[model samples]
Target: MTNYGDLVGGDRVHASLYADESVFADELDRIFTRGWVFVGHDSEVAEAGQWVTRRIGREPVIMTRDRDGSVHVLANRCSHRGTALCWEHRGRATSFQCNYHAWTFGLDGSLRAVPYPAGFEKDRVSLGLDRPAQVDSYRGFVFANLDGSAGPLAAHLGRGGVDMIDRLCDLSPTGTIHLAPNWIGHQVHSNWKMWPESDNDGYHLNWVHASMVSSAPDTYYQETVLGGETGNQSLAVDWGDGHVELDFRPSYRRELAWLGVTRERVASYCDALVAARGAEAANRSLWDGPPHGLIFPNLFLGELNLAIIEPTSASTMVHWHTAVQLDGVDEAFNRRILRQSEAAMGPAAFIVPDDAATAERMQLAVDGVQPGWASAADPRGWIDMSRGLGRERTEPDGRKAALISDETTNRGFWRQYRTVMSR
Candidate 1:
């Protein structure tokens, strides 16, 4: 067995984790298959017979809402000759019929009918298409694990992971978040870990996103509070077993300024949000700010209703910028937020292409390497997660840093990554 502990340290990671194809295959089994991976939000299949097809690890999964309003996730392959049951991204269907062979299945995954009555023996009728080992939901997000022995989704997420997502959904006044109709999906040539690692590493914010910082100079504080020269950012690391949280200090004031908002304009925005969601709920949504972290293997939730990451291989990723409007918000305001998010963070946005370019280049460099590693050393032991290292924070979740260039969160992510992948 490989010593996963040695491969990970407070400051750096083994290059093998990225360069080795065997490692990637092992990760698919150890981490992706064993862990509870997010599929989609419940709102995607709200009506009976509604269904969406997704891939969990390498397995094709079909998620459906049965007639009784219960959600069921099962393999998308037919039992007769092993053909895909659903071809579209999403739709409403009572029964999924295999186009290749006439086999059909119910929404709950039970075999409904098989054409040609004399083709099979009656004794073999009991065998049906396989169901997912387990399917569960937290809030409105759905997840599944191929390993039946794996625990419930809630237990898998633990408290810290659940808290992060709860804060996200709770930000919506209705206690629910809907997927945005507008979305951007891209396939990066880099490994899957790059997305989550970038989220955890705040140091890249000022450098990788320097263009945004420069373009909207007036919007940010002169000091670059979140991604500036002084590096006044702080990090909070919550160790929730398999789940974790890497909270960055609030530094979006400058971005808000670009939107023509200020301390004085807070009330107006709050009022608009309240009118849309309700006073109490709007308050919660406004205060959650932004998060820079991960929900284990996949899932990157960020500020401005941004949720983007990979659902399959390291080469592909989906990005969505969503805003949950209550029953009353102005359509123009929602549209403006959506545009801003896409312009700045969408796949076609200014910085995303550059990031994707770098990821691709990195993949080419490491594609056939025998052994390789990415460096994580910085002055901060656990505290200075920006720019590599700085110092550890005194408090449990606290990590003091002078700028957003710290790597505290990156270390936290890899720490958990090693744990899950090694097992």
Candidate 2:
């Protein structure tokens, strides 16, 4: 048995937790498998037969909607020889068939037919596709869990997390958002935890992303994070249940100085929002637009995009960034959104690569040595996470918040990781 107490300390965790093979294997089973991990956006498979495949935890799974419009998160591996039936990222298909043995399955994963029905002495209808234990969606975001007994999505989201997602969906006048086509993927040579920890972190922006501050467009996000926003509108907030949001509303700008984009654009988007969603809701959005939130486990929303952390190994992981589209917003507004996201989050963009490299570089520092290079007397190495430990304040609305530069969100993550991984 692992002594989780030793791995997770008082606002600090052992360095070995990022490199130990045993810990990595255990995380797949304990945290990812049972938890409600984000699979894909419901909009990705809105139409019948549309599907997308991704890694749910360590296992490959396919998210598809049937002809009847019901969605399923089926294990990607075929039942017969354990072959992956769906290899494409996404496609429109009437059914999935195993190319190796010609085993066919439906969109709902019911095994439809076999090449040789008589080869089985038993009934041919016996074999069928399997769905994850629970699959559900909030707004347009879809999540699945292998644990059948897990709580509903609303329960998992709690108040703060749900509020953050609601803000994201409410950006669209129609109360929906869609996944944009172009997605950027990066295979970072670092521990999976690093990418997620950076999501809700505001401390590293002026330091790690100094280049971004100097070169990138001065947009709503940068202005807020850079301390140009008035009052407490911009904040680092901890949403309960291990979720945290970099809470801030975007400044009104049809065109930003960043990205070298000076053309007047998205001018009437807010007016359209007010017209459709009403002045009260529009004003609320302008005041508290959906902040970039990191859902517990490995899902991220915002920075005008969606990011997923896939744990490939203890020392390596894959991160996916997909630009998101507001359903009722115009092309000009969406174009502006994607342009800003690409300037930093695009595969070749400046910000993402820096973040990815930092994760790997930090992993390289995991030598597991004593502070003074002392003998094996106290060789258990630790990474101090004590920053902002005692400064958290509970908001009247039930969220735990802290200074923008504080580490409250990161600590919230480690504590949750400890609880889930311990069990």
- Ten-residue region with minimum lDDT total, candidate 2: 250-259
What's the lDDT for candidate 2? 0.76
- Tens-digit lDDT track of model 1 for 253-288: 342343445535445555656676786766544644
TM-score of 2: 0.91
What lDDT does each candidate get?
Answer: 0.62, 0.76
Can you give the lDDT of residue 391 in candidate 1? 53
On a 0 to 100 scale, what is the lDDT of residue 422 in model 2?
Answer: 79
Q: Against the true structure, candidate 1 has what lDDT?
A: 0.62
TM-score of each: 0.83, 0.91
Q: Name the top TM-score candidate.
A: 2
Candidate 1 residue runs with Cα over 4 Å from true position: 122-126, 218-284, 305-308, 311-330, 372-390, 394-403
